[model samples]
Target: MVRGKTQMRRIENETSRQVTFSKRRSGLLKKAFELSVLCDAEVGVVVFSSRGKLSEFSSSSMQRSIERYKSYAKEKNLKHRGAEDNIQLQLCKQEAASVAKEIQLLETSKRKLLGESLETCSTDELQGLEVQLERSLTNIRLWKKHMLTEQIAQLKAREKMLLEENAALDRQWKEECLQHSAVSEEAAHDDRTSQHTEVETDLHIGLLGRGRTQCLLQA
Candidate 1:
């Protein structure tokens, strides 16, 4: 009678287990060859013993058979890689969105600091912003003070120049006044001498007329 089908359990005896492995490995290879021959197709088989020994069979040179297997494997990998690339693209988009969100937050913060009040900010936040504005105002005040100091220096320089110009004008005016006084004194002296000479001539003529009258009466 045909032995009943062996139970599906591990063979406890090492020799039996090894023998079974060999038999199964050979049967699988034989089946592979049969399939190739019947279908007029290429075939390859590879097995490893429990002791880590390798066994292989192929329709062609082992290298060529491996290369062919790799080519077919690459085709499968390409299909999987397309899916993987889509997943990676989705991940990249998510990361970019996250980065964009972070950038928007930073921009909002900067805008808040620059005195732009948005609906997102609270009154307390606005107060903090006001403090920062006050600090900025203080700095501006200091800068204005510096500018005013420079302007004051410039004004002082202009004032000194004006003073010098005024002093020079005063000197010129004093010199002109002295010249006019001297001219007036000389004119007055000439007028007095002319009047004295006219008076003396008149007195001499009158005396001469009285003497002529006396001499005619005596004649």
Candidate 2:
């Protein structure tokens, strides 16, 4: 009968657990020693038991091996970071070149639009430029016409406002003139009444004085 594969798990019994730990630690140390001797490699192994006991193997001093591993890992990380930085630098250069090319194309097109560099243009290009210019002119004229319409509407509105204001001012001036005329007439009537009263009193006094003189002459 074929033996079934055993599942690996923690040994529950304390004695069995200790025995397994001892066996595994020794086997790991032996492997590290063999690897160092046979392949001339720097090998290190470390293990800790549940009770905080330590087991370690190193081709050289443990401290030296740990320091070497740290330095090697640090150097490898620096090399990887430098490679990423180089890739980023290359990408930036490509993007800058693309932007520069786009700017150059835009400048060339601008010059063409301004009629500054037409000597190198082909017949088809000139025709296209002419069509573009005509379309632009049409759009400009339409915009100008629309602006003028708006301006005319605004001016008409302003004229209507001014006319309304003038009408209001004229009506106010007419009303003020009517009030002034009425006041003047009232003042003139008062003056006339006062003069008439003074004249009547003077006439009555003259008549009475004459009667008194006649009565004295009779006496």
Candidate 3:
């Protein structure tokens, strides 16, 4: 008898859905194991249930397999990158040339502002360069002021942190010193008590001997 095709839809009944998931998951894992054993192929599988429970299988070390896969992908990418190497080199060269040209223009403008190369400049161009140079100097001064302000703020924050750390260390040292002083006092008290006890015992013995000698003389 030909079995009817199962429709590809979610089972609305909760129990039926759960049962179907369990059966399918077991079959999938069994097939994976069979493939690994029969074909001697490295196989890994991971499945998550609707409840976020995980099931995993690996024929060999999963970590080794993942690293091997990454290596293969990296090797493929390296080979593909070879084709673009020349294009990247050309772009880098073009960028370098652009930067060099800009530097040369800036150097010429600087020389003109420093009273050199002014022989070729017209009166209008010289006035324009003077105004441009003043604006640039003003911008530089503003930038320098901003940078100094930022540095001062950073230094103040660092100084505050250092002060707080120093205060904590000083407090800790004071506490340790107090503890040590208390311990020393306690030890000194013990020693003084012991010395007093020894002196009392010796005096008592000496009085007892003197009393015995007086009794012998009176007799």
Q: Give the number of the best model, judged by TM-score.
A: 2
Task: Quantify all predictions' global Cα lDDT against the true fold.
Answer: 0.91, 0.95, 0.94
Model 2 spans with C-alpha error above 4 angstroms: 1-87
List runs of model 3 lying over 4 Å from the truth. Answer: 1-107
Clashes counted in candidate 3 amount to 0
Model 3 poorest 10 in a row by lDDT: 78-87
User: What would the per-residue lDDT of candidate 2 be over residues 9-36, giving only the tens digit for each residue?
Assistant: 8778999889988997898899899999
Ranking by TM-score: 2, 3, 1
Q: Is candidate 1 or candidate 2 better by lDDT?
A: 2
lDDT of 3 by residue, 1-219 (tens): 999999999899999999999999999999999999999999888899989999988899878888888999999888889768978989999999999999999999889988898888999999998898999899999999999999999999999999999999999999999999999999999999999999999999999999999999999
lDDT top scorer: 2
Tens digit per residue, CA lDDT, model 1, 1-219: 898899999899999999999899899988988888899778888888878999888866678888988999999999899999999999999999999999998988898887675677888988888898899899999999999999999999999999999999999999999999999999999999999999999999999999999999999
User: Superposing every Cα of model 2 onto the true structure, what RMSD results?
Assistant: 5.5
Give the C-alpha miss distance for residue 169 in model 2, angstroms: 0.8
